[model samples]
Target: MHFKVSNNGTAAVLEPYISMGGHAALLKNDRSVFVHLHPIGTISMASQEKFQENYTQGVLDREDICFFGFADDSTGNYFNSNTSPNGEVNFPAIKLTTPGNYSIWVQVKSAGEVITQKFDFNVIL
Candidate 1:
């Protein structure tokens, strides 16, 4: 799942998502599965940065992309949104481990205010 956070209905202010490290949390109603996601993927910022650094340093080549858990073609250009009139922050995909009801809290800070939007979904196999 992905979220497109915009400002004043048109401009997508995604700095918070980046500055906050793309913090998105999920909780199953039965409390069976939980995961924290970043803009790049379901990985910690430290590790993500490390992998990014390695990629830039040439220590890791394109062929070695699979070595990093957070590297994915789908998200390779996740942060490049300059072409879009509204900036956008794309969240990583969320896969439910078990079939059940789940609640997602998509929190983002815009103009110094932290906004939280709650969404519920039922997963069925």
Candidate 2:
């Protein structure tokens, strides 16, 4: 699989040759700064399904389902603004907070097998 990345100061935009299954990025110096990105968005599909299930079953109050501390937005649509239809994954710009080394791990599924590729980059302030 091949990937092309474009760093826009605060975030990195990735265009993969093929559709991606899952992907993540981490600050090499500070592990606390990590983000998992998907083709859909920040919220995982499993989480969305679970939230839907709970909402459908009336197990949780509609007003109580908060996403990333935002209430009344259980669908996670607010955080999914970077979704693309061209097999591109756009990570949040906040992930590149400080100038240092970073690693982005991209995963793709092919023929029922999962393959992971790690790409390294440096952020200079």
Candidate 3:
């Protein structure tokens, strides 16, 4: 699902993984940035309240569920964050000490019981 905050600094953009990643410059010159992570693409999540009753009576694999982050600069000096209490979804944050560009990413894995997938809304300041 996509997120809209009326007139907030955060903006969403669909960046598809290209054959070569293409020529992109994830940079900005601002401060007090915000990143709203929404569910992008996922491995698929159905109903799984009952583990044994579900698939082969075993837990799912969710260790691959990891998020990736990158700064706008080559120096790599950006902060990172994760989801909230339940951990279903999240909005990772990065406080910019220097007004420059930064890149953020997230990967929610499909576990045996619970899992989630979110997007990255960049507010580069």
Candidate 4:
């Protein structure tokens, strides 16, 4: 839901789910994510279902986490990931592999219906 940037470091929120349905997307109008970046240094990303006590604004309710890459080798699908059943993507950390165009998405639904949020970005590795 937020990206923290500083001389200290760059931190992003990422979910482990293979789809774009989660709490981060549920809280705001912006559904998708796109980034054009070549990491200047080490980066850390996470999907936080429950924010730590020090976090003033906290997470709502959830308990699943996932992180995925490139829906397919094709460009049309738009690489993305999100949270699962409990609105929580269950992973806490990820190690950098490679870099290129990247996409991030979050989704949420209610009353048997569904909604989707997505975004795309580039990693200039």
Q: Considering every candidate listed, which one attains the maximal TM-score?
A: 1
For residues 1-125, write the lDDT of model 4, one tens digit per residue. Answer: 33321223432233322233232321112424323221111123342223333244543322221132222212222132232222322212233345555455444343344434566655455
Worst 10 residues of 4 by lDDT: 34-43
| Candidate 2 regions with alpha-carbon error over 4 angstroms | 1-20, 44-51, 54-95
What does candidate 1 score on TM? 0.61
Deviation from native of the Cα of residue 124 in model 1, angstroms: 1.5
**Predicted candidate 3 versus true structure: per-residue lDDT over 8-40, tens digit per residue:** 443322221221111122233353443433232
Q: Estimated TM-score per prediction?
A: 0.61, 0.46, 0.21, 0.26
- Estimate the Cα RMSD of every predicted model relative to the unseen true structure: 5.6, 9.5, 16.2, 17.5
Model 1: residues with Cα > 4 Å off, grouped in runs? 6-8, 17-21, 44-87
Full-model lDDT, candidate 1: 0.58
lDDT of 2: 0.49
**Candidate 2 vs candidate 3, lDDT winner:** 2
Model 4 segments beyond 4 Å from truth? 1-93
lDDT of 3: 0.28
Write the residue-wise lDDT of candidate 1 on 1-125 in tens digits.
55666767776454444444346678999888887765546666698789779989988654433211223422233334212223444565766768989988876655556667788999999
Worst 10 residues of 2 by lDDT: 81-90
